[model samples]
Target: MIASDARLAINPNDKVLPSFSHMADAIVRMATKPDRRSGDLLLWSDTFASLRRLFIGVGAGALVGLMVGLNTAIFPGLRAMSRSFLTFLSIIPPLTLLPILFIAFGVGETAKVMLIFIGTVFVISRDLHLYVLQLPKEQITKALTLGASDLAVTYRIVLPQIMPRLIETTRLTLGGAWLFLIAAEMISATEGLGYRIGLVRRYLAMDVIIPYVLWITLLGFLLDWLLRLAVARLYPWYRTGKE
Candidate 1:
């Protein structure tokens, strides 16, 4: 009855866009059915494959970005040396580097992960650098006056304050991360959300395509929610400071 009602809501001649019921049906079919390219089920395998790339790429990038931001903000000389280069990287369209990445790294998982990492790392790093610099110089002076070493001031005084900001930065960059992941997967991956979407596009598989796109969106939302939850739980003080 639900399916029939959904069909009635849409024009019978329309084949380009699937109704919500049709999309739900296609999602189930993809979830249960084995992929033609891979023996594993379509949605399950593709989702995880994309997620693995997302985690590795974003995880590594965030860690490095945090360090870059911290060190650059602490040391003016280092910031001067690399600031322009980092700015250049952040502004260049990461998608434009896809071909070069594929050529340099080949069409493997490495290339896909690198694409996401490169896409996000510079932006996150720069944002955090500016954020850290905004912090009062009095805090650092007090820490040094209290006999804190340079490293001690950085990790002890500054790191805790910035960790929450890192999470927020990661949340903001998640969309770009997905974009790079999808673009890389579409170009060469044998099995991924983007791979499947690109593969089925030739056949005009709106049912599969729509569901997969929605699934990506759902996954992104869940990730963002989780990050927000983590920030709230782990750094209540951060929010209190903001308030």
Candidate 2:
């Protein structure tokens, strides 16, 4: 693959592709450099910062989504209002609202987090509402027959059913969250994996771009794997056990 890329790069009209040797040297140089802008340490720190933004956004969004979803499911009075609002949010392109987020929340971390939040929250909420509605009606009746309150029914019967599903939904939404995060970083972040990649792209730094892209891919894979393991281990009943 590198050889073919080298061949293509050798053509004057084609884009330059750094050889493996150049890439490796770039990695070594980057890893040892003390310059915070492009140093490997800086990259990792920025990556962690971005991860923090992602984690907080997804965590808060999922929790809010679940609460709002369940509330609308249990209380039909609020159903029309909440459902319509969430549906409105779900249909809008999140990227199109970037300027609004920046204007409302500013171009700082708040806007970035809000961007990610909007990207995944409504979708998760809608899916969670569907899952809640699909639950066996008999369970609610059974819990009520035992003298359980509405809140008790939701907590004991519905919440348990959706917890695992929520985790799974979050696993799927991680991709969207990453997209929003990178887009936010590319737009205004001073330090982040996305910012670094966009920065290097201006100079046609293939050696840096390739590794950064691979690193982002690896991080995403690991996050998905961890979520899968959590579902398998913590919610064994939810697992299909297909493997």
Top candidate by TM-score = 1
lDDT values, one for every candidate = 0.90, 0.84
Error of 1 at 35 (Å): 3.5
TM-scores of all predicted structures: 0.92, 0.91
Q: What is the lDDT of residue 111 in candidate 2?
A: 95
Which numbered prediction scores highest in lDDT against the true structure? 1
| Cα lDDT for residue 125, candidate 2 | 91
What is the per-residue lDDT of model 2 for residues 15-43, given as tens digits with 9 covering 90 to 100? 36766676777766665666654544655
Question: In model 2, which range of ten residues has the least summed lDDT?
Answer: 8-17
Point out where model 2 deviates above 4 Å.
2-15, 36-40, 241-243
Kindly provide the TM-score of model 1 when superposed on the true structure, using C-alpha atoms. Answer: 0.92
Off by over 4 Å in 1: 1-14, 241-243
Model 1, CA-based lDDT: 0.90
lDDT of 1 by residue, 1-243 (tens): 565456656766454766677778888988987767667888999999999999999999999999998999898898898788778879999999999998999999999999999988999999999899999899999999999999999999999999999999999999999999998898899889999999999987787898899889999999999999999999988888575
